[model samples]
Target: MFFEGFSLVTQDVQGVRYRFRSGGTAPDAIFLLHGRPETHVMWHRVGPLLARYYTVICPDLHPERSPEQQVNDLLTLATITGHDKFVIVGQDYGAHLGYLTAATAPDRVQALVLMEALPAATHEGRDDMAFSLAQYNSCWFAQLHPKPESHTIPVPAEWLEKPLPAESVFAPEAVADYLSASIWQHARTVTWAAACHPIRCPVLVLWAASGRIGGWYDPVRRWCDVTSAPTEGHAINGLHFLAEEAPGDVETAISLFLEHCIPE
Candidate 1:
């Protein structure tokens, strides 16, 4: 059975049971990673749209994995699919993985797309422009929970309504899958490697300009400032779920950027 237009599949790679979906006959490929509190199903709408032009793979990646481990998992998955190079797009927590994938193995990645997420820069858990209580609030919440890894973290319906409004329209199966997944196998707010490496590929940072992420620090500008590679950013109207709220904007941004990165 297909979840949306893609076939649901799982592969055991490097001792981890990785779940993902892949479809399309095109030789070119794109990988989609979801954010915390959600699964690969988060890319339901946007993934299929991109699938028309390129093979799209959406994976339920363990964000808790260290940058290096996550990158290894990604490469293994790519190898399983007979791809040495492919574009990757990530949103929110998924973008964290994207940064590492690009920085750690720049040669394997063709282009990088990040949306509503921060780079793997050093953050000391202080209340500075580099960090925010609200931005990292989920981690703070995890720390407060007595059993952060017990899969018992209660979903704050009222609190989440702001960022994920009723109109956001998440699928029931997607929400259930996200809630069932263990979100705390790794420690909360585990910073990236001691030294943040520069990404060598073309980068696109798409952000929601609705003022949710830029309260204290402009995250979009911050992303551009931290990256050493060729990078550009655009702001769109929506909540934190840019793919759900503004799929068209996401599509346009990625298509335009990939045009330059993968010029044919």
Candidate 2:
């Protein structure tokens, strides 16, 4: 089973159980965090692709835990894996939390790969961007769901038919997993509310040019401006999950970046 390496492990922290994919050699761990409404399953395809070279760990951001608690769980997981520092790859809500975890613990994060990540400030610094999908006539689920209590719009399979700009980057399985997981978890927008200060690590921001969330170029640019970490941004042709949509391109970028950070 490709999923046999995947397991649901429970952590004492907050009684939360997260999914992890265990494979690869020692010294380097590639942790994958899924966005809202999704779980470790979101990276089923991409994880194995990277797992061939590095240990890939994907954890479900169970809506039950707060952002702080989530990071703590990540740290505990890292400790359990015997890794003091590791690289992190995240998408959408996952990217948002990745920034927080990296910023809070620079020593623990060797490198960061963020896809369709939200600027920490965007959650509060700008209110005009928080319009509803009805008002904005766009997919503004994160903004609309300001709190955990807000309702989540179910993203059905039909939505994929009208592929967004970056659809080519991911395979059908990746998209299906994201859609199903997000729909199952009613509190899919909580991570959007998470914000952070500057971080001090190598950072890569991969934004989906066709993203329906706040695809504001300026906001994306500001993330590079505010981060103390050495940062670079690339506008890709995919939707939110660039890794799944364009695994080859993403793998190339990730491998090159990790080479400089992890060292052969």
Candidate 3:
């Protein structure tokens, strides 16, 4: 659930409607992007709290968009809201956008935070075609998941402390939007491999434990060694879902990054 009094609005950006929940009085802005099988709702724990100090913008991104398209979408949202510059915190799929947006437009981003995501590729480049294929195999059904009926994919009981229906994860509209947008798992990987531009802004990467993510992507190595900017890597002991299982750790990492790495 969102913080009380927060308004949910849908804005048409380049003919595509994007939904977001926003409410805060702070002049500085913070954009939150959620990962797969989730919507902006994942930020309920930290978003309301973050709003106390910053204007929080959480948007539901359909997984189909490439890293660059996501960047454009977020930029459009920023322009609509009249925020020339803002901080961005994203998890899983959302983190990909956060990293790409920061790298693509250093001047537009005040700060960037990525939690438990695929590490940003450096200038050296990478070979993740197989990894992409593996994901494709796993989610093949998900892409075609809405053949006859469409609803939120039920969240497994183990993923959360308490069991919840997948419909409860995000709004029905958001769930439908994601199902419609989901596609081309391998193509997105190629996009990331090519999106390895040098980052020029302050970055905070909250990396999850090794076994939580892909076996091939070395989340720790590249994240710690990223020289594109002054980057800090903090290891979080949790599942792939950062905000859910390790909210306190995520909050602590964000607090430290904001307080020490970036100026308010």
Q: Best by TM-score, which number? A: 1
TM-score computed on alpha carbons, candidate 3:
0.73
Cα lDDT for residue 220, candidate 2: 45
Each prediction's RMSD over C-alphas, in Å, is 4.7, 5.5, 6.0
Tens digit of per-residue lDDT, candidate 2, span 1-264: 344455556555446555555666755888988765466776766776677778877776765666677788898888987888899888877887788888778888889988775575654555364443433224444444564234434443344674643435444655565666543454534535434555778887777667744464454466766676678767766766565566677777787778787766
What's the C-alpha lDDT at position 177 in model 3? Answer: 43
Better of 1 and 2 by TM-score: 1
Q: Candidate 2: misplaced stretches above 4 Å?
A: 1-14, 122-152, 159-197, 212-215, 218-220
Q: Which residues of candidate 1, in runs, are more than 4 Å off?
A: 1-3, 122-126, 129-168, 183-189, 194-196
lDDT of 1 by residue, 1-264 (tens): 225578889899899898888988788889998876677887887887788888999988876666678789998999898788899999877887878787777888889898886654533343564344354444554465554455334553533443455554565555666667775455356565533577788888888777455444566566766677788877878767788778778887898889889857
TM-score of 2: 0.76
Q: List TM-score per model, in order.
A: 0.81, 0.76, 0.73
Score candidate 3 by lDDT: 0.69
- Highest lDDT: give the candidate number: 1
Consecutive 10-residue window with the lowest summed lDDT within model 2: 129-138
lDDT, each prediction:
0.74, 0.68, 0.69
